[model samples]
Each structure stands twice: as structure tokens, then as C-alpha cells.
Target: MLDALAARAAGPGRITVFEPSPHLWRGRPYGPDLESVLVNAPPAIMSIRHGDLGHYAAWLGGRAAEHLDPLLGEPLVPRALYGEYLEHTAETALAALREAGWEVRVVRSRVTGATGAGTRMVLGTEDGQRHEADHVVLCVGGGTPPDLYGLDGAPGFAGDPYPLRRTLDRIPSGSDVGVIGSGLTAVDVVVSLAARGHTGRISLLSRSGMLPHVWQRPVERQPRFVTTDRVAALHRERGTVALDDLVGLLRDEIDSAGEDFAAFTAELLAAETDDPVRRLRAQLDAVDDHRIGRRFLQLTAHTVGPYAWRLLPAADRARLRRRLRTATGVASPMVPVNASILMRLFDSGQLDAVAGVRAIEAVNGRFHISGDQGRRTTAVLVNAVNPAPQSIPRGAAQLVDALAADGTAALHPDGGLASTDPRLHVIGDLAAGGSFITSSIPAVAFQSARAAAAVTAASDSGRALSG
Candidate 1:
């Protein structure tokens, strides 16, 4: 994203990147110690421009030293190393900008608040400092993790799986960890805990039995396709997808394409590997709602040609032929794995599934939770609970509420994702209303560019970026 910004503000302009976090370029999601959060898609899936291959990765992680590209296939790089690359790129960008007579300052301070001025911005810093800028880009990045929502006096849980590794070290070793959700975050916590050598037991509980698929390499390549229908397949746009139905639809699409959807997607990434995000977004822009009907079929069936015969449903294939394909609702029982770490825990009779976690209460020193199933015990209750976009925020919800009431921003309906015109931008998982299978490097870079452009325009117009 910084690269995109620098490229856009190539001419005479001043851009100040006000990042409060310790790690500026990498943001909070990519902390210093995160080395194994391998990107899922192929390198082709990443990009800034429509054809800029590996621009972000080349700048961030450098060319993959290995033959396999994690962004393209199942390769995983030390996420921390990626962070280093980002820092390096930011420095390089700063130097070039200075040499070219562009004014840029990367400040390390938390912006307490900002009021949008028509031609400028009034920004308050953490140390009670105040400043004005010609423009402001509110790249707040991801929000606090879903698990940290309601807990009080949470001195130490197992560890925060979010950005910032120092927070984890704050917790004492050998502490039993109670993970609230069973999905990816839960898995992430388990993996990180093991990495840190936390010997205490880790218990994971979630309403649904859903778990992410095991990583597998694609076997064969498929073809590009465009399905002209999709509304009926639009199920729970703001939440976890129906694993079985989603897999089934992709299975069918690949079958038609004469290969597995994964392989086909691999090929697509490889072909567009240079700048897949931009090209894909451009393609989506071209289609928009004009081809909503087609999008429905393409969403699920589209992947069928990508994933080989490894996983799918026979019933979905028959239904796609007889039914409108768009009529089938997109939700299905989640499939589990035999070798996954979470599955291994489940198999060990350590973790169990709860129908739903209704409320969390502080009973004595430990937190108590009640749900549809019943109550349970735990050493430390880490709220792995996913954020419910529709749910009302409690009394303490402050920043966003203040921002919305003051008319500085709006919310995207599907997930209440923060909406900003141009000067202000959101990135990472917190940004709403984008592709389901999205990446940060490219998609995030795209947003940063938009934000930076707005800032540059304001500075040129003798105005504020937030205006």
C-alpha cells in the first residue's frame, strides 16, 4: 500500500503516513514475530496495477528464494520477514520521495482524534499533541479482534493472536488457554501457542463445527469461465460460507472445466500472477450488478473447474444440471479433517463444540459463558467469538460511534464496514464489501493508493487530505 501511495504521489507533493503502531509499513496484522502466516493464493493473485506482477511481494518479501510461491500455491513465508520487506520498501520510498523533492514524514504516534476540515484536518496525538494537515488518510487497518470484544480485566489470556508480539510475551508461560472460536483464528492461536511453547492445554469452543480445509497442492489447471447468474447463491454474505455447498459448487464448476477448481485458480493466478487483484477487481467492476445472475452461478460453480476431484458433492452436480443453479441456497455442513491440528485436538477429546455462546459473564475471577448447549469451565477464556456486524455495540463503543455521528464516515450495510470517500481508507480484514477470497498485499495496496491519491490531490489543491 505504501508503494502504491509513493508511486501515485510521484510529483511534487507532501504525504505524511501517521502510523501509531511500532511497525509502520506492515501495520498491525503483520507483526514482527509472525513468520508462518503463509499467503494462500498463488503469487499471481497479488498485484497493484492490472499487470504489475509481484510488485508488492518483490518489494515486501523479495523474489521467492524457493521455487514455490506461497502467494500462488501452498507456500508459506515468515510473515515477519514480509514485515521487514515492507519496512525496507517504506524506507526506500521515503528516500526516493525526498531526493525527488517530495515532502513525506512517517510519524510514530497514535492519532487520538481528527475532525475533517474542508481544506485541512485537526489531528490530536496520543501525547496530547495537536497538528493540522492538508489531507488525512485514515488507514486504521483491521479492528480489534472479535475475541477481545467484551472481556474485562483480561490481564493475560493465552495470548493475543492479533498483531504485536510483545503483547503475547506479557503473558506468563505454561498458562492454559481457552480459545473462544473454532475457526481460523482458533487454529491460529493454537499454532502460535505451540510455537511459543505454551505447555498448558488449549481448549477451543465454537457454535458451529466448521473448520478450514487442509492445505493441498493443485494437480491440474482449468479454464477461465463466466457464469451469468448468482443471486440465489448469495447466502450469508457477511459471515462464514457454507463449507459443503461452497465446495460442492466449485467441484461442479471444475468438473465442467475438466479439472479441479484449485488447479484452474492456480492457472488464473499464474497467468495474472503479476497483478491478479487489480485485474480481478477490474473484471468485477466491469460486471458489477449488471451480471448479478451470472455471478451467482460463477461464485460457486466457477471454482469447480479449479479444484480437481479431491473434494466435492455428487448431488450438487445433479442439481446444477436440473435446477436453475442460482436457486440453491449457499450453506452446508462443515467438513472436518483427520490430520489438522484442531482435528487432532478434537480427536484427543480436548476440545468440544458448543451450539452457541450467548453471553460472557465475569463470575468471580474467571469468566463464565452460557450458550445453547450449556455452560463449561476453562482456565482462561479467550474470546475467539467472531464479531457480529448486526449486533449493537455496548456502552464502551466510542471511536466509530463518534466518527459516524459527526458525519465523517458511513457503514457498508452487509457488515457495517466503515465507509470513507477517498482521504480515509480501511484495509485488511476490517475493510468491508470486497471479494470473499481476498489478500492484503494487493487489495490493501489498492486501498492505500486511493487514500494516498486523495491526500496528494488535497495537498496540491492547498487543502486537507480529510476534507
Candidate 2:
């Protein structure tokens, strides 16, 4: 996102980034991290430009040639390596802009609040400093994890789950650790802990108790069904796809699989009678190509997830949420290596699963977690649930909250905020009416480019009108 913004805002007025880190391009995902931390996808699909899918590959070839031996193939490189790529990308863009005579400053401070309006906007920082700008883009990345069980600031609870390498260190070695969710973040926590040689009982607790599915090596194939044009057609015809139509489209796709649609979907949604850990482990061992089915369904969702979300009536959205919300946790499966480590831990009796963890109460420097099935107490409890986009303020940046409070920004009916003040634009997960899969590097790049173009056009128009 910073790369896109820097390119657009170059050759003119100052473009000041309010990030405390000089290497703002790295963001949080690509920040300095252990080599054990690998990217979910390969180098091919990671470039900022859609045409240059191999840009990152080329970068790797020069900087870290060993990691790029397979050249055109997909290899999950280290996360920090990606960080270095981003820093290099940003530096190159900055140098070009400087040569073209534009001032750029990567300010090192937290933006406390954004006040005022329109072209007169003032972004206040923690040190009682303010920076004025004509347009503010709210690409502040992911929000804090929602306090699912109100465990914020508790002794044995961790609300913010990033830098798992450090946060997991607080847990005493050999102490039982209860992880609250079983999504990607939870998998990372478990994997990081095991890598650190923390020999302790790790309990993965959740309502469904389902971990992410294993990822397979990519096969070159375009989306067969659920094309974007189909979604556009629906919008063209009725302007909105009701909950029933959405379900019917999925059912149609399932029918195309040559199986009993009803039975197939039922089996898909049915709970595993066997232990989930054992099931995932067996999957890892057998390594079937069954991910094709999941990939199709996922691609279908991505095609319509964002637009369909906005078109739904408020009541329908709530119904859809109630039915499909929990399914999201297991939607995007984890990378294979991480899944393997988790399976190994579970097999070794060091890791466990607890179902229906509804609440956590801290006591005696420990956490007592209770749920529908049963209860358990653990020495340390880590909240592994990923941040929810719907929950505003709880996980949102303070600037977003402040703007929201004063109605400078308005929450989109779909999810994120829209600001009438200063034409504040929100994108990525923070943008309500966008795909839930924006966490992907490609998705972020695409959206960032679009946002930068929009910002440039808006700035140009403002200048023209003023002149």
C-alpha cells in the first residue's frame, strides 16, 4: 500500500507517512521475523503489479538467490525476506520520487487522532504534533482482535496476538497454554511456541474445534465456476442477490460436482466424529488433492463475498452472519508446514482441543475457561482469534474511532467506515464493502493501487477547482 501511495504522491507536495518505523513498507506482516515464519503463498503472485507477477521472484533472485532456485515455481519464503523485499521496493520508489523533486518523510510516531475537515484536516500524533493533509487514506492494516470473552488486560490473557515469538515467551516453559481460536493466528501461536522449544500442554479451544485445512501446491487453473461476470450479471438484473439466491448459487455449484447436492453439503458441514487433530494429521499423511473442492467454493465466495455483502438487506446480512460466520474461521486453510507442526504437537499429546469456550475468567495467575461442553484451567491463555471487521472501535485505530465518534466518518452498512470529512478513504479489511480475503498480498496490492489512483484523481480535481 505504501508502495502504491508513494508512486502516486511523488513529484509534488510532501507525502508524509505517519508510521513510526522508517521501513513502513514492511508493514506488520513483513516486519522483521524469524526464518521459521514463512509466507502463505509463493513468490509468483506477490507483486504489486498484476502484469508483473514475477516481480517478487526477480527481487528474490537478486537479493536471496538461493531461495529462488526453483525460479518460476512457488516456494514459501521467509516472512522477513518479504519484509526486505518491501523495504527495497519502498526505497526504490522513494529514490525515484526524490530525483523527480518531491519531498517524502516517513514520520516515526503514532497518529493519535485525525481532526478538522476537508482540505484542512489535521492528523494529531501522540507527541502533541499535528500534520495537515488534503486527503487521508485509512489503510491502517488489520485491527486488534475482538475481545471475544472480555479477557482484555487480564493476567493470563493476550489480546493482541502479533509478534507471537515474543508474546508466547511470557508463558512459562512447560506450562499448559490454552489458545482461544483455531484459525491461522492460532496455528502460528502453536507453531511459534513449538519452535521456541516450549514443551507445554497447548489447548486449541473454539466453538467448532476445527483447525485450518492444509494447503496444496498451486496448479495453474483459472476459476471455472463462480466467475466475476456472474456476480455482475446478478447485480445488473436484480441489483441484489438475496440470501436464498446466494445459497442457490452455491447449491448449483455443488450440483455441478456430480454428487447429491444435499448430501454433499450436509457432509461438508457435519462435525467430525473423530478427533479433529487426528483427522488433520491423517490428511497430512495421505495428502489427497481434495483441496480442489474447497478451492472452488472459496473462489466462489471471493467472487461475490464483498458485493453480495453490501446488497443484502440488513436482516439478511444478520441471518447470513449467524449461519456462515463461524465457517469463516476454517475458510482459508493454513499453509502445510504450519499445519504439520500443529498435527505433530497434537499427536505427541503436547497439544489438545477444547470445544465451545464461551468465556474466560482469570484467577490465581491462571485462566479458568468455561464452555458448553466443559471447563478447564490453564496457566496461560492466549486469545488466538483473528480480528473481526464488524466490531468497530474495539479493534479499530484511534483515528478511525475519533472520526466515527464525531460522524466525520460513517460506518458502511456492509462493514468499514466512510468519511464525509476530508474525503477520508478506507480500504483493505477496514473497508466494509470489500472482499474478506483482502489479507492476501495480491489483494492488498490491487486495492492499494486502486486507492492510490483514486487519491491522485481527487487531489488533481481539488487543485483544479481551487485554481
Candidate 3:
């Protein structure tokens, strides 16, 4: 979106981006030294620009082709290299903005709040400086997670297990590491430890004991019976569809697929494959023709998720929250290589998946966990959970909280912060509930274009009025 902002703002006032880190545009996911961590999506699907799905690949082809790894005939590049790619893209955008005589400034302080009326906005910084801008874009992805389990400040309790390559290093060699969560973040933690040749038993603790499904590069699919257009039509006819209605629709689609859908789901959840990664990839290959159909349905869900989510009665939304892990497990699967690394660890008796994580307590100079399998002691407890939709506070940051406090910012009933004043635009993960999937690169790019267009139009209108 920053890229789009840079490209579209031709009649601009100064463009200032507040990034407290040296890693501009790269953000948290693409931070430095995370070379071993693999991206969940293939290079084919990860482009910061719309209609140019191969943008990242093309960039890599020119500079870092060697970083590409061929798995299942798709390129899975290192996360750090992707970070470098983003930095380069940002540099290009900045250069273009400068060439067009627009001042582009990167603020190196933490932005806490943005408050003002109409076009005049005051952005508050942590250092007591109130920087002003004509427009403010809240690209604050995910705010830092509070210690959900009250394990903060405890010995060997590592909060924010990000830049995993570095954080996991603090664990002693051969120490047992208990990671709370089964998503990509947890996978990265285990993969990072394994890649660093750390000899330790890594336990993945989750509610369902279900790992993210292994991903295959999607084949072209057509939505035969289930399409977004149809879902939108249903929404029009009913004015709103309940959660049960949507589920029934999905069940019908799966039923229409007959044996193929049944087999795929069966294989996906079955414990038959000791090597879960290989089994999943093989299952996907077996259903190659039908794989895209499932993907198309998933895409439809992404399209309908926001509407369905918002239309859902409060009770149904609660149900959705309860089933979120299952929804996430199927909807956002991991790439094969990361799963393969996990499978290898599992096979080596170095990793185990534990269920029923009921509690965590500091005990005897170590961390003790009581869960589905009873109690276990570990030398390190790492929180690898990603911040979910409900995690963002009204005042997630100082600026956001202040906006909420003064009634300048309104919380979207679904998710995200909206400024009562038009100049403030919030997007990304923070804009959850506004869209079903805002975390992916493609989703972010799509959103960035829309937001950029609106901001640019406003800038042009301002210029015209002044002229």
C-alpha cells in the first residue's frame, strides 16, 4: 500500500512515514536475519502489486535468483531476501516521489496518536513531538500482544517470539522449548531452532493439536456451483445470511464435489500419515484437478467472510470465534518446506504436538505446563501466537487510543479504526473484520491501491480548492 501511495500521490503535500526501525517497508515479517524462515505462500502468489503476481519473482530473478528453492515446482525464497526485495521496492517508491518534487520523510520515532479536524492532523510521537500531516494512514499491522497467559517477566519465558532466528538463540543448547501455538509463527520458531542445529525437544502446544495443513501451489480453478457472485446474490435476497446458512452453503458445495472432497478432508485430518507433511502433499497431488475447486471455495469464503462475519448474530460470531482455530487451520495452511522441516523434527523425536493447553506456571526455575497430556516441565516457554482480530485495542497505539478517546476515531463494528475525519485511513491486520484476509501480501496490495486512490483524490481536491 505504501508503494501505491507513493505512485498515486502526484499532487502531494509532504509524505512522511513513521517507522521506528531501520527496516523500512520490510516491517516485522521481513525483518533481518530471518533467512531460514520460509514464506507460507509461494513466490507465484506473493506480489506487492496487483495484476503483477510475479513481481517478487521478477525482482528476485534479477538480483537473487540463487535464493530460490524448487519444491513442488514452485519457488520458496528466504524471508530475509523478501525483506530486501521490499526495501528495494520502497527505495524505488521514495526515489520516484523525490523525483516528482514531493518530500518523502521517514520518521524514526514511535507514533502514538493522530488527532485533529478535517485535513489538518496532528500525529503524536512517543518523544513528545506532535508532527502534523494533511492525511494519516494507520498501517500499524499487529500491535504487540499482551502476555495472554501471564507469563511475562518470568525466567525463560520469551515474549514476542519474532525475528525467531535471534530470539530462539537465547535458549540453552539441549533445553526443552515449549511453544504456545500451532500457526506459522510457532513453525518458524521450531524451524529456526532446528536450522541453527539446536538439539532440543520442541513441543508445539495448541488447543486442537492440529498443525496448519501443508500448502500446494494452487492450480487454476473455476467455482462450478459455489461462487462469490452467488453468495453475494444470497446476501441480496436474504438481506443477510446467518452463520448456519453460510455453513450449509459450504456443506452443499463439498457434497457437490462428492468423493473428492470427502477424501481430501479425511486425509487432511486423519492421523494415518506418520509423516503428515508428505501425506498432505501426496493427497493434494492426488486431487490436483479438484485442488483448485477447494481453493476456489476458500477464496469465496475470504470474499464472504467479512459480510458473513458481520451479518452473523452475536451468538454466531461467538461460535465463529470458538471455531477460529479450525477455520484458520484449513483456510491458511503452511507451505510444504516448512511442514517438511517440522515433520523431520517430529520424525527425529525432537518435536511433539501437545493438546489441551489449560495453563502455564513458573515452577522450580523452569516453566511447567498443564494441558491435555497432564503436566510437563520445560526449560523455555515461548509465546508464538499471532495477534488475532480481537487483539487490537481502540487505542492500540498512543495515537489510536487518543483518537478513540476524543471521538475523532470510530471503531468499525466489525474491526479496525476509522477517523470521523476523512483524512485518517486504517488498513492491514489492524483493519481486520473490514476484510476476512488482510494479512497476505496480495490482500494488502489490493487494499493499498484502494486507500491510495482515495488519498490521492483528496490531495488533488485540496490542491484545486487552494488554486
Tens digits of per-residue lDDT for model 1, 91-131: 88778767766767766766656665564556666677776
- Provide TM-scores for the models: 0.64, 0.85, 0.87
- Cα error, candidate 3, residue 278 (Å): 11
lDDT scores of the candidates, listed in order: 0.48, 0.67, 0.69
Superposed model 3: Cα runs more than 4 Å off: 62-71, 224-228, 242-290, 301-316, 393-396, 412-415, 435-438, 459-467
Worst lDDT run of 10 residues, candidate 3, spans: 458-467
The number of the candidate with the highest TM-score is 3
lDDT (Cα, 0-100) at 244 in candidate 3: 70
- The best candidate in terms of lDDT: 3
- Please, what are the lDDT tens digits per residue for candidate 2 over residues 1-467? 55675566635655676766445667666776666666765576567653467888888885554554232234667788888888898788778756756567777787778765554667788889877877677667775667777778888788776667668768788888988888777887888888889887899988877766565556555454455566667778997767677667666665676546665456445534446876687556534453345555655554446656667777887785664433463356667777778777877889888877787888878888888777789988887777665445342467777787767787776667776664466656776655444445566676678767766676443221000
How many angstroms is residue 463 displaced in model 3 relative to the true structure, after the best TM-score fit? 6.4
In candidate 2, where is summed lDDT lowest over 10 consecutive residues? 458-467
Q: Over the stretch 1-467, how does candidate 3's per-residue lDDT look in tens digits?
A: 65786677774456777877678788778877666787667675678876577888888785544554444456677777788888898899878867766677777888776667555777778888877766677776775545768988998988888777668778887889999887778888888888888897889987667676666556664455455566677778988767777756766666665635556556444632334445544534543343443465456655456545656667787776665665676667776677767777877888888877888889888988897789988989889877765347323456667878867777667666666766666667776355334366666677678778877776463321100
What is the total number of backbone clashes in candidate 1? Answer: 41
Error of 2 at 192 (Å): 1.6
Ranking by lDDT: 3, 2, 1
Clashes of 2: 2
Q: Candidate 3, TM-score vs. the true structure?
A: 0.87
